[model samples]
Target: MATRRYLQLDVFAARAGTGNPLGVVLDADGMDTASMQALAAWLNLSETVFFVPMQDPAADYRIRIFTPGSELPFAGHPSVGAAWAALDAGLVDADARALVQECGAGLLPVRVEKTADGKRTIELCTPRRQALSTPPVAIPASLQALAAADAAPVLWSNGPAWWLLRANSAGAVRAFAPDFAAIAAFTNATDATGLVIFAPEAGAGHDVVVRAFCPGDAVNVPEDPVTGSANALVAAWLAAHAALPHADGRYVASQGRELGRDGRVQLRVDADGDVWLGGEVQPVIRGSLDW
Candidate 1:
């Protein structure tokens, strides 16, 4: 058996145990797709990352993201965590401000900025065709099973894979008691795999609070800790369409409150139409795999 090594880290968090966790396969140059899927199932986390060092000078690297069920073209938290892992591994040069990652979806740039701690921060390019979907005048009969009907539904996305929905209030988000079988049926019916519902903060000093759920995978549960990139894309979409104020200002997002592992994520949308999601990460466990 051949042994493979990987690093484990928590992302989109200020501290440990507060954010989404990821397993990063540091040297996946030879691993195949079937192997990756099996490996993801073995990890049993939300996502697993595999880094394939690129030989081409023009490319920074390549990454493969996989859930337990299948591979994904792109994912927000894993992108950030993977870039940080690459930097920590010295895979890319310090002066390399931009990284081009070739994934299943396509080639996307992972922009990097150096922090005072000598770590590089990563921001990924959102998909060009992010959707703008508004709920019907009356709540759809299909979604009536969701906890709150009074809240408005706004849909958007950063990547081709997921459609994010922003709801009206925090209570509405927390009260979501979904029927997995029904939700899965709906996803297949509509060709949507994931849904994120959020609400505006009730008080000052907070920007927005949200919850993310991906039903395509087994158990069909919402994530305990979701990263800020998807939310940043949603915010960008909202600012563009709704004319929301402070769209250019730095925003704070609170997630995972419903699951008791509350997390804070920072976001900034630039004038150039680029969105940035920033957060800290910490290493939790490390191990190897046999293939």
Candidate 2:
């Protein structure tokens, strides 16, 4: 039997077993594509991240993210989780300000932020581009499978994928019971592997609330706990449409309450046209893989 090491971390959650869980293969430097895909399928998390050394000093490492079936261009939770795993294990030094994570999408910056607790939070910067003038004119038929009588879907993107639905009321958002099979079919049909459903938050503390689902890749389940990227994209889309109250600073989105995995993510948008997403990743399992 061949022995390999892997680290599992619970991302976008303050504690373990709550947020979107991710598996990282530390010895993935020499593994081929077929092996990576097989390992991802075996781990069966939202995504599995593999690291390869890069020659450029500008970038510390080459990171690739994969689901059970295929590789992904970009993803928020896995990026956060993988970076956390790399740093926490002392694989990447602390002094690095910016490390370019090379993925299918291209080289993206993973900027490190120091938290109050002395831990690090990595914000993956998205490529600068103009937001689409308008969201999808109407909800797609697949999204309509989860739609209510009052609200339809809105298509928006940041990096990974765009949210397809935006409800008219808090009740409408909460009442959406998605058809996972239909969602899977829809995902297979489009480049988007995930979907975001949202509406205004009911309480006064936050601006809005939302839920995320990624049936195409990891955890073929519905309602991801905390989604920083989706919320950031949503916030940007909202800002473009002049819907949100604040023009600057960070916004927090809370999700996964209905699905039992309560989580939160903070999104920061600066005047310089840069978006920052922050979340916590807790190391859950330190184990090995024998094949």
Candidate 3:
């Protein structure tokens, strides 16, 4: 009924149109929750972000994240995409070198690092880690059949709930064809977003290669080109259990090769054990929405 401005963003992309796509609906104030959910379902992307004036007094702006199926308390790519969209709309300034984001998870601090070319890298502080129960036998067996890693599947949450499985090599992660039926059953039983399979070292410019798979009954996203929250969980777990060999407390991770998209996520663990997940965003389409 009215015109609104929005941005289509590519998160964690090394190039345009190669990263995960996000729709940031700005000027979305007064839009009812049902309308927002309907629009998100219509958009049919992994997730859509809606921005409005701050509800929390401490936050500069408040954002709501919705997938086609349901709403999420927090999401990585949407947070990054929202940050870029907010910056573009003058909702935030970099004077303090940080941005605070308020969502279902609470207030999160985001670091703003600007490059020489005026491109900015935004690193959002992930919520404290929440380690959940282990995966069922079938889940581990499913991954074992494809790869030779014995590492058990771990379910954890930084924002949205997740399950992580470790493979022996990055090649193993790349070559496997997922059994979505079995995986969906596992997800149903465990209430996790999906499975994230990763290896210690791989890729040309990254320390680790991660592949995320989300299988569902009807509307399913077989693979996520880039996932911020999953990698954040990985960083927290590894920092606590097994430290990386060359870790200067920060490293770059690669993902999305299965989808032919070169996506990179920069994860850092500060001396205080805080995990920061970040990436560069590229605006693919800048326009106004009328609907």
lDDT of 1 by residue, 1-291 (tens): 667777899887667788888999987878888988888888788888998766556567778888776677777778778778877777877577887766665666777777787755567665453665543334335454443454344455555334455564567667776555655655544555466666567444457777766665531334536855457666675566553336455677788766667677666667777676666667777777776
By lDDT, the better pick of 2 and 3 is 3
Q: Identify the runs in model 1 with alpha carbons over 4 angstroms from their true place.
A: 53-57, 94-97, 114-120, 132-157, 202-205, 217-224, 243-249
Model 2: residue 270 alpha-carbon error in angstroms: 1.7
Count: clashes, candidate 2:
0
Candidate rank order under TM-score: 3, 2, 1
Reference-based lDDT, each prediction: 0.67, 0.69, 0.81
Candidate 3 lDDT: 0.81
Could you give candidate 2's per-residue lDDT for residues 30-99 as a string of tens digits? 7888888888888776678887666456666677788776777677787777777778777788656566
Q: Taking the tens digit of each residue's C-alpha lDDT, what string does model 3 give over 159-270?
A: 6778877777778887878887777777767878887888877447889888887776322567778988888888887787665535588888888878889898988988
**What TM-score fits each model?**
0.83, 0.84, 0.94
Number of clashing pairs per prediction, in order = 0, 0, 1
Query: Which is better, 1 or 3, measured by TM-score?
Result: 3
